[model samples]
Target: MTSYVVSFPIRDTVVRSDNNIPWVLAMHSNVVSIFSCFRRAAATCRSISCNTGNDLSLWAKERVLAPYISSERRNRIERVLENRTRNVVVVLEHLHSKGNENAVYRSMDALGFQEAHSITADEESEAGQASGDPRTDAGARKWLQIRKWHTTRDCLLHLKSRGYQIIATAMNNRDNSSLPVQDVDFDNKIAFVFGAEKDGVSDLAVEMADVCCFIPMIGFTQSFNVSVAAALILYETRMRRIRMFGRNGDLTDEEKRSLLVEFYVRALTSSKARRVLQKYKYDATDSSMTENI
Candidate 1:
């Protein structure tokens, strides 16, 4: 088995160690290390909780990168964090065009949505294409959790298991079969499924959906662009959420802190810093920490 090592910086003037060197944590075989944050480093200590391996990884990354970010930047992250929600998610089924997907990502990120799922049963590369428009999307890809599944059933089933109401976006012609996006209740947890560009929603996806939603169109056009529809729907949902729970909605302090850590980590730009961050992302998923423990 191959072992992985994780290292992070410690401000020299504030943190003192052997020869004033940076802090390093080496994990091998069954060994792991945990470090505390600066404010409470003296009292806090490391513990080996096999179940908390992923969480430990998060904390470790936050510890290393959080201090480097400015207070102004942190405040900006906090403001966005309040409006963010896991209550609603967007899903795209078999979407081939990177442009459409990137647009949806931009809209989702703008509305403070934290996750998006895709069922690319036919095109496996759709998920990877999100990286194609980093500049255009303004790096929204870094902030959102995008998941790709192989089948519509698999994606819907997983969302259902999480207690999300799967709402499929349907065409205008499907009158009785669909409701206006605004008419649908945004109070409940929803996973909106948008189909491919050519075919729209899959038959199976439509069947599995808890409800079908359509955007109202007055003109001769049958539908809005997939990306446009996504923006409109998310905007409506955001407004509804705000109406119900103020602009900040129901996001908790813990949630804000978690997102702050992630956003702070992502804000790092130097080549050396990015390389370290990459290791943190990869090693964070070490399944052995869960299965073997």
Candidate 2:
């Protein structure tokens, strides 16, 4: 045995060189190379993690928020989403009461209807509506999507393009072929058109209507208030739809996935919740927007 000696420490393990300088040098080089690879691997992992955490996509927000959601709230979100529908909807034609508009929204939300259309008295638009919150309704509307059309014709035409039959409402006397509200066919994709009690249904709306309907009455009042009419009609439609299709809602799997993420993001409600999302790089500005219902 030679007397030459050297020390190479790795994890406090000292390899005895046995006085072979070339072997010692090779072993040291290997240790250094191994450590270099380990450091590279660790850096790569960190970079991937950082990029994933900074992603602001809805699915990314969902991934970050999933752990924070309580089982109860998650299940509630699922239940509500399961019952909501975009198939059947309502169209308001220049209703006089903004309060009535809010009330209509409340009814729609309470009935698990997801979308509504309206004819804005002003020259506005009815496109790309993702939410609605009217101060007049005591914050009763949820994340209910509303689209407003400037004219009744435009609203009717848009609905027609989407394969929806425009069912306009008026008293039975206004149209000879007007069916009772309950008697009307709810099987088809429908957009129920309601107008203010004072002015009644628009002449243009009646002309564009695929079919006309009127709520049955036995009392002295010839017509129900617009808000009352919405509640009644929506409740009836939801019930009839369930019976007709044997399902609570008609949203597809893809629709459910999209909506589920939105509901999850919306549930990050409290200020404390906002801070939690911030750590995950979520945009907190969206959290400030609270929907009604």
Per-candidate TM-score against the hidden true structure: 0.73, 0.70
Give per-model CA RMSD. Answer: 9.0, 13.1
lDDT of 2 by residue, 1-293 (tens): 33222233343322222322222223344676656544544443343334442455544455567777898998988888889888888888887666788888888877888878877755233332323446655544545666656788887888899889888888753448998888988777899999876987788888888888877889887878888998898888888888888875777886776677767766666777677777766665553221211
Evaluated against the true structure, the overall lDDT of model 2 is 0.70
Model 2's TM-score against the true structure: 0.70
Which structure among the candidates has the greatest TM-score? Answer: 1
Residue-by-residue lDDT tens digits, candidate 1, 61-108: 666676666778877887788778878889988887778888898888
Model 2: residue 17 alpha-carbon error in angstroms: 40
Angstrom error of the Cα, residue 245, model 1: value is: 1.6
Model 1 residue 113 distance off true place after TM-score fit, in angstroms: 0.7
Question: Which candidate has the top score in lDDT?
Answer: 2
lDDT of each: 0.69, 0.70
